[model samples]
Target: KEIMQWIDSENSKAKVQSSIHNFTDMCWKKCVTKDITSNMLDTTESNCMTNCLQRFLDTNINVVKLIQAAQK
Candidate 1:
């Protein structure tokens, strides 16, 4: 039982991590739509990437808070 619980916890953690990565990727593309290559090309892209991460994190926090409130 304990081992199963541990596995479930790890699974949840992995899912959350993947979700964050996906959100980051999506926002990066939106913020850097002009990139001609598979990689970020310049300081503008670098800045966009940073902004993408910030937006993802901020939005995730708000969504989580709403979920918690609804659960109450």
Candidate 2:
């Protein structure tokens, strides 16, 4: 039982970490428009990043609800 509990805990942590990294990558791609040479983000990039993050969170919440409903 103890070993099983440990495995479950690790699995949960890994899942959360994976989700965070995925969202970070998705948001970065959507928001960061400047080329490597520019080295600076303009107002547009900043706004895009913020909007991307918000939209990502909204999508996650909505999906979770849909999944829960389907389970029922």
Instruction: List the candidates' TM-scores in order.
Output: 0.57, 0.61
Instruction: For candidate 1, report its TM-score.
Output: 0.57
How many clashes in each structure? 0, 0
Question: What overall lDDT, based on C-alpha atoms, would model 1 receive against the true structure?
Answer: 0.83
Q: Estimate, for each residue in 1-72, the C-alpha lDDT of model 2 and write its tens digit.
A: 999999999999999999888877888887775575576667787788778878888998999999999999
Query: How does each model score on lDDT?
Result: 0.83, 0.85
Q: Compared with the true structure, what per-residue lDDT tens digits does model 1 show for residues 1-72?
A: 999999999999999999888977786677767837765357877787778888778998999999999999
Candidate 2 wrong stretches, greater than 4 Å: 37-51, 64-72
Best by TM-score: 2
For each candidate, C-alpha RMSD in Å?
3.4, 3.2
Residue 60, candidate 1: Cα error in Å is 2.6
